[model samples]
Target: MSQQSVIQIALIEDDEIVRLAISQRLQLAGYDVIECADGESALSLIPTGFPGIVISDVRLPDISGLALLPQLLANNPEMPVILMTGHGDINMAVNALRDGAFDFLEKPFDPDKLIETVGCAIEKRQLQLGANKREEYLQQAQGLDQILIGSSPGMVELRQQLVKIANIDTNVIIYGDTGCGKELVADCLHKVSTRSQGNFVALNCAAIPEALFESELFGHEAGAFTGAIKKRIGKLEYADKGTLFLDEIESMPLNMQIKMLRILQEKLIVRVGGNKSIAIDVRVIAAAKESLKDNQGFRQDLFYRLNVAQLYLPPLRERGEDILLLFEHYVNLANIHAKPLSGLDEKTLLAYGWPGNVRELINVATRFGLDASLTVADILVTKPLASIDSSASELSLAMQTQNFERKVIAEALRTHKGSIIEVMDILDLPRRTLNQKMQKYDLHRADYI
Candidate 1:
């Protein structure tokens, strides 16, 4: 790697001999090493953007390595922290791992093992930082005012794909679940294109009556029919030199599908009652909630014509942390000053499967903003107790027991601020057993502290 891209490692060990030895080893292995003699020094020296993994001894002179782990994580959760433990400190080392230590080394450990572990952690960190940078670049390219707001990998890919397709004047088919922002994607396509100055006409194929579909799409001449009192420009003509967004295109009447296919194929349309053909310079962007190929009612020829470009939008559940990100966005839009979500609130939000996708989340966020006394219960699909019951029922007995134990231990740790004695007393666990359980769940007392 170039010097600019070289990974930096923060080595924190109070023992001068061990610190120097490890630092030299890491440096020899092509890593830039920042050496600190104690936890307190490391805390000040290793800034949030340290850009590497931390290797520290558990028994630091000023503060225990366990104590410093949480502080480092709080600064940058993605920064890996490795712990070096001494003989008879296996439990502490294990506990460190549970508490979010990337990996642990039992001293008198092999130098090669340390180097190998550091290499793996560095690679992982680089990948994470690279992803973040890519997301940032895409966002900047798309502009802050862009409607698609997310940093998830899926969203990043979608934005890049949208930017590529936007410049091309071709029909696009968007496949997404209801409320997954299909219309927003279509609008973005129109805004970034050459036709941005022209009108962006949107019509829901499912919302229009079958009888009026012809007139609504292709327009009618004056006195062409019983109710045709005036010459009307239809959606297609209205979108001339711009873009037409057809939402729920799968619901269009079968007979009308032929006319749409003809207009797409010929780049011209005849009025509902008149024979004069008008050339259209409009780009069609169609969206469907389900796969058009699987829908028996949809014509195969029309599907192929409109699907010159396709974009598959992931649901809210699959978007990971974007759920909370979007929720905060909607809350801001609602003009509500809200505090950061509590742990329980965040957990509940992540657990629920948002069948209604982003639309449902928007509704909840709006309601949450409007209602001062709103709780997670007000927005979540299942009550807390019921959700727990449902989860427990899904797992095997052994897995359920372990899950409950983890929760209980975590709660105790949180309540007592990682005080081992207090947690042991509250949970009625022996010291050794408590340590074992903590390590198993990767629970760190320092986190609560």
Candidate 2:
């Protein structure tokens, strides 16, 4: 392979003479070069995954090289960065290496030495990139990492615990906030379990009313009740020799909990209004937003039966950089006509507290994927993306006026970034009137901000 075609180098230095010198050396050494005069220029010039290494001076006209290193690495951590330090800055240079710099060059170093260092960094970069591609390909090919996708420490630990627990045949109770993938974890457990060939049944305990819980869970015999027309198999029976996932277990009424405990203890179930008892050999996985130990109404005995093993799914807020990774994952999965997410979009997503967790993220990703014009801010905002004017003719004049006022105020708030003074100035309204209108429409400045 020709080094000039495969390897690229970015030289960032404020001194034109030094930058030109290094750029020419790398070019003469049969490598491509991107030359920038300062830190800020370097940041914007070096696009994400810049297929090369960086050689920057320790002292820049604007941001310190040390500070800029983190921002650069945030986009591509494996991209090697080298610092050119003055004689007195040797200590700082050593610390940079400890903090992730690939190598450091002292001022007035031999021209040959620069080439030698660049060669070593390029070799390491190639290896790192190759490893990343291999792992990504493997993950695409049905690896465990493919199903549970997140690189945060919390996710890594969750996957480790899940793998260990999947081998065991005991029941598991998953604890997590709503939409944080409790059901996904349960599915993962089922897919890797010894009984993968059998049916995997799922029932939401909360969705079924208290009166219907019995019929939904234990099933009913023909003429079991006024509505029972025929005999049917319950989740436990259908999941025999397989896995049964019960979501929102906390919503189960006390009466049903008692019946569930009995079925669990006996390892069998009897259909409602039926005399025959059917034996069931199955593993049960229960999911709840609240901890069973602290739930005053849940039966401790039943908790023990189901809590033989447990997994805690961390909320997206706590996953750090994993937020961006998941957003990109969903965006790619959608495969629609949408612009690629920018760095500012990543910041906007990371700043907000995701109350709806993964489900909300998936929605935002899908919406953005489908619509080319919507920004991340637009998706995060409470207002509808596109309003319909077809109903304006049917509405009374007063109603239309009110809607128009709300839209004007909302647009001002968004444009001014929730600045009350600016909004009031633009709308020509007194403070009290503006406040009343905001209250009437249930719009808060914090939402726009």
Candidate 3:
């Protein structure tokens, strides 16, 4: 490799002869090698975000390579660490790999094989760095305040869709489970739109009383109603040339839905106790936790009008490793002293299905920051499952199969205690296939342990 493209390798070994041999071979292969006699020296020299991989002997004079693996991973989760072990300690090497070591090599290993493995690791690291740079560029362009904290495929696609629709004038309907940040997404839409200069009026339909729904939404002239002492501007008029976010639209009374639909259709509103028609230019973004389709309470015509552009926010459970990313973000925001997650904490975070989504995660993170001694159980407030009939016949064959698969995998993970190799052996699954299933089911090995 050219000097600029040369990959760096941190070589950690106590044996001077062995370290020299490895470093010479790596250097000959056009790699820049940093040699350390022990884990202590390596830790001092190799800072976090070290632009390279590590090659360490399992048995070190000061600290074992297996023990050092966690520190390296905690510094840079994407950094690859390759461990070297003797023939008799192959099991220990495998255990290290299970504990997050990138790969392991046997004693007296072929130089060419070592070179090939290192080359592959370097390529993977380069790709990850490129992706990180691209994400940073996008964050700068879009403004970091408006960026969402996630790297999952769903989140990536969601950001792209938001950018695509930001400049358009179409009305948007956001559908998501409770506490899934539907309002946050709506705010982002307004911030990125042409009407960012205008006020963003937000109202929860369910919070308003049935008798005052009209006055609250469309405003009223003084003395229009029993409590109308002064002329008041409605949410619609207040949001003129801006955005109106209607939260929990499914809870709006049926009668009010008709008036709301008329206002949207006419682009005009006539305040109560007034005959003059006022034209308004406002973008509507509605959010609901429940589906509006086939609901007798919701008007189908109004639903059709507002559903011109729909955005579905995925729940936190389906967001994979984003759970950890978001937790760290909250921890930083809380400004509490916290250590990197490992062992049982890692597993607990990955395994729990966050029914309350992002809102619940933030609360847990806040608690974690405040109480240093808090355990995973202390943070997890498990929600009870909805009652299900004890009849297997009620479920389709495909649903039954999927449930069985999830159960078996979960059981294997529990038995193995987060050991990937053990779980793979027990389930008789290839590594790639097991990973795919785990991702599909939102399962994490760390969570199980």
Candidate 4:
């Protein structure tokens, strides 16, 4: 509602007597009317700020009101449109709605009903405008959910570096194994930094072919190469005033690396076959799996340039407790997709080392969940229970406990047909106690029968 208590409404009608009657009724209902005799004139007034609502007859001279609806919305989608059609013009009203006309009032409409429809349309328009503004704010904020995962000493130190370096505009080199979430760390820095609102572009140096690497990094003028039919924009230009992520930098061609070094020095790029140099303001985030010190082929000068700052990601095996945290995260994700939840059985968790890191844990958890019948016991049994070496009596105790745990759970599972509640009752234990024991012995009731 505005300071003007009466809402301003535009009416398009060729019939004079009906228009007067409708205008009189609307005026009495606290509305200010701007009347038009044809659709073309009404459409022209749409951009001139005639009124908040448009009430138009379907059939009009010059242009049909139904046909003008789309053009009206293209100019200002917030304006509500109510179409007026005669009894036999139901099809036109339906077409108006499909084309995004807010609402329709069939000719000979009740005055009160028409007023209600306009009010509803106004409310919906306000809601949409608010929602759009909120979304814009969220996009600008770049939200904080992109932080990398880990709790190892290496990871903790890396996070400390991120917090310290986010304010500085410097090149960064990230080192990590494949699937070790190096890119995730890059994203976190970009989002948390002062350049959060700018574009964050990524290119895999290894994935791009050698033949097209030059053209891809730098734009080209029309007729630059044999197949270069048109002028094109490049990633370097697109990432201006933003951040560019160069992944697998170790695999970048030596020739391209040299060109990149020059670009880093000059802060400008010359397109292929184009002499004009375009100045760019961008930050670079380069990543590689190999150590900069060990890789002799990597240009030491280039490494030094990118290494203005560096962050190393620890593999999953090194983050002892963080492995279980990641495991629970995956389980929750699986549940959202209607998959079963699973956790590591004690024996299997303690036995098999996670060589594939956090990525391996997610993969194994996904496999376990998709096969919903798999339980703790099944996971334990599949893993080898080797190396019971100890003092003779201690080794005997270990074997005896493992066998006893297995036998009790196996008999209980058989008798109960794998009903979790029934098994708990037979064992006279709480659900967590049963689950703990099952995990301890690597026992899965689902796999037993």
**Tens digit of lDDT per residue, candidate 2, span 324-384?**
7677678767864456564335556676577778887899888878875455655665434
- The C-alpha TM-scores of every prediction are 0.61, 0.60, 0.61, 0.54
Clashes of 1: 1
lDDT of each: 0.79, 0.79, 0.78, 0.71
**Cα-based lDDT at residue 345, candidate 2:** 55
Off by over 4 Å in 3: 1-146, 381-449
Candidate 4 TM-score to native: 0.54
Report the Cα lDDT for candidate 3.
0.78
Q: How are the candidates ranked when ordered by TM-score, highest leading?
A: 1, 3, 2, 4
Q: On residues 338-375, what C-alpha lDDT tens digit does candidate 4 reach at each position?
A: 33222223234333455555665676666555665554
> In angstroms, how far off is 212's CA in candidate 1?
1.0
Model 4 pairs whose backbones collide? 346-439, 376-443, 377-443, 377-444, 378-444, 380-442
Off by over 4 Å in 2: 1-141, 383-449
Q: Tens digit of lDDT per residue, candidate 3, span 113-227?
A: 8987787677656545644553464445445233576777887887778878889998999988888898889989999899999989999998999988888888899999888
Q: Count the backbone clashes (under 3 Å) in each candidate.
A: 1, 0, 2, 6
